[model samples]
Target: MKKFPEHFLWGAATSAPQSEGHGSLNGKSPSTWDKWYEINPEKFQKNQGPEHTSNMYENYIEDAKRMNDIHMNSFRTSIAWTRLLPDGKTINPEAVTFYRNYFHELHSNGVKPIINLFHFDMPWWLMEKGGWESRESVDAFAFYAETCFELFGDLVEYWTTFNEPMVHVECGYLYGYHYPAIHDLKKAVQVAFHTIMAHTMAVKAFKAGKYSGKIGIILNVSPCYPKSHSTEDLRAAELADLLNTKSFLDPAVLGIFPQKLIECLADNQLLPKVEVQDLHLIQMNPVDFIGMNYYQPRRVQAPATVNHPAVSPADFYEHYDWPDKKINPYRGWEIYPEALYDVAMMIKDQYNNIPWFVSENGMGVADEERFMDQTGMIQDDYRIEFMIEHLQQLHKGIEAGSNCFGYHTWTFVDCWSWLNGYNNRYGFYRLDLENDQRTLKKSGIWFKELIDRNGLL
Candidate 1:
């Protein structure tokens, strides 16, 4: 077993809307998710919504203790925008107290808290006004960022401006999976541009406040691979990469949009409206670090026919199923551990080897209870194997001088997903939703030992 660095962050990552239940309770307000679920409950699998998740809002202290028991020296979690600024303007005092105390408890327990400002749960009021499509939404997010730095910045040392910004843009605007569902290519481009601008503004705010913390953004980066050596397949893969990876990566890290991507968008009349000053802000306010969420690599093949200019990104390329590829049976995602190593190499060669971490990486399973053993604990050997293989690849990346720093799995406890809800479980600890009880799965125990030894065993 290879040992990780002494300071390597070992913990779990979770979002507020998915984990912290008690929606709109204790002076909180509705997020876009809450409103969406209310309007169309059928959109969520098993009809599970954010109203009552894992109860993390009230059970954070106990949860922090559980995290400590697992030898988690660090944790990454997001704050609910609606809970903090219910009206998108006024600060909720109760939410402030809750977060301050919750973070204090984590700190007191020898656990470092990595906080994120946005995690796809925009305040309902903000979403009602066009969400990320309007410039006003950018300013609103800046104000919220400033307030967070003032209130809880002291408790957090590592702050993230946004978590998976592309997911919100693609899912909500292009694919119509999330709230305020719209399938216009232009709106999607506009939303994505505004999101990047908001991130830059927030980064500026965090630096101007001079808080003793480092701020960055989290991106889900899945490098695109061509199915064959043909020119069409290569072009298709490059386009897929531009849409999936470089769209946010170049702006965030390089502070400039890729010329090819810009040309493509302009040719299609899908270019986002941008101001000269906005470009300056983006170029000047680059992130101090990056958090990467890796799930799987995308394999692309050339479409049979070129689509119209107004086609959504999803329609721009055809996804290829690699022949005889291993798969995650439950999630239907290709299991390619080597993609992590490829991502690390790409970062090293193209992105100046910036400091980064695997912010979210884990497998989800359906009907996980069927794996429980006689001892009343889930004997999730599959999860353990998954982690080991991925970690081995990550270790190789570090050996190759990739500057990778940490590895945080998808979640700490079983919680609600956005569209999938609790249908798929991806957690170190199992949460009995019916009883509101928490139990350690075998994978959780394995993680504790791994952390204690600071390596795989």
Candidate 2:
């Protein structure tokens, strides 16, 4: 087994809304997720909402102890916007004290905290005011970012401006799977534009204030592979890449939108309205690093029949399931471990080999309790295999000069998902919702060994 770099980060990743319960406690206001669940509880699996999950809000000290028990040196999590600034304008003192204490606890346990500013839990007030689609919301987010830097910047050395901004745009605007579910291409373009602009401004603010840490954004980058060698298939794959990856990647790393994407947006009259200085801001503030969340590759082919111009992104290309490919039956996503290597190589060749890490990569299984043995532990050997294969590919990327640094799985403990609720569990520690007891899964114990050895066995 190959050893990871001595300084490679070994930890688990989680988000606030997903892990932290007590949705409306201690000066915490409702976020978009809270509002969405209230209005459409049926949309969530088992009609569960974010009101309670892992109870990290009250048990973070114990959680930090568990993280240390696993020999984790770093942990990635997000602070809820509503928790920090309930109205998106004023800072909540109670929330601030809670976060300060929580982060301090992590540091006391020798765990480095990588905090994200936004993780799709937008303040409900902001959503009512047009959210990221409005320029005003962008400015508000910049203010919120600056405040976070001033407050918790001393405790956290790694800060991410946004976690999977593209997912929010695509799921919320294009596919209508999230809150304010609107299916408008024009709105999607505008939302994406503003979201990136917000990231740009946040990065600029972080640098200008001389914050004591590095700042970056998390992108879920899935390499697109054409189904065939034909020009039509290639074009379809390129379009898919443009929409899914480059739309955010080009701006964050290259500091400019791809010319092809710009031309396409112009052709469709879907170009977002931009201020004269917005481009300058984006170009001036490229991120110091990037965080990639890779799950699967996109297999695309040219559409058999062109849809009308009014069609959504789904109409732009046809997705084909590759024959003979391994699939995660529980999540319905292809299990292509080699795609990690491809993504890393793409970054090396195109993005100047900026320092990056796998911010998220894991498999979620439904009805995970069925895998639990009589020992009262989840015998998730399948998850162990998943992690080993993915890490092996990541090791190959590192050896091939990818400049990758770390790999954090999707979650540390079982928690609430936005729409899926508790249907899919992706956790090292299994949370017993009935009793709020957390027990280490077999994969968690294996991860501890892997980290202690600094390599796979």
* Candidate with maximal lDDT: 2
Q: How many Å off is the CA of 428 in candidate 2?
A: 0.6
How many angstroms is residue 212 displaced in model 2 relative to the true structure, after the best TM-score fit? Answer: 1.1
For candidate 2, the 10 contiguous residues with the lowest summed lDDT are 307-316
List per-prediction Cα lDDT, in the order shown: 0.89, 0.91
Which segments of candidate 1 are over 4 A away from where they belong? none
Instruction: Summarize candidate 1's per-residue lDDT along 1-457 as a digit string, tens digits.
Output: 7988889999999988888898969888988889889999999998998999999888898999999999998899999888988887888999999899989989987889999999999888877788898989889999999999999987999999999998998888877888888788899899999999999999999888898979889999888888898998898899999887899989889999999999999889898989879988988988888999988889989887776784766556788999879999889999899999999998899999999999999999989999998988998899899999999999998999999889999889998999898888999899998977898999999999999999875
Local accuracy of candidate 2 as per-residue lDDT tens digits, 238-356: 99999889999999999999999988788777889999999999999999889999988899999888755536776668898899899998789999999999998999999999999
Q: Residue 83 lDDT in model 2? A: 87
Q: Model 1 misses residue 152 by how many Å?
A: 0.9
| RMSD, candidate 2, Å | 1.0
Candidate no. 1 TM-score: 0.98
For model 2, the superposed segments whose C-alpha errors exceed 4 Å read 308-310
Could you tell me the lDDT of residue 410 within candidate 2? 84
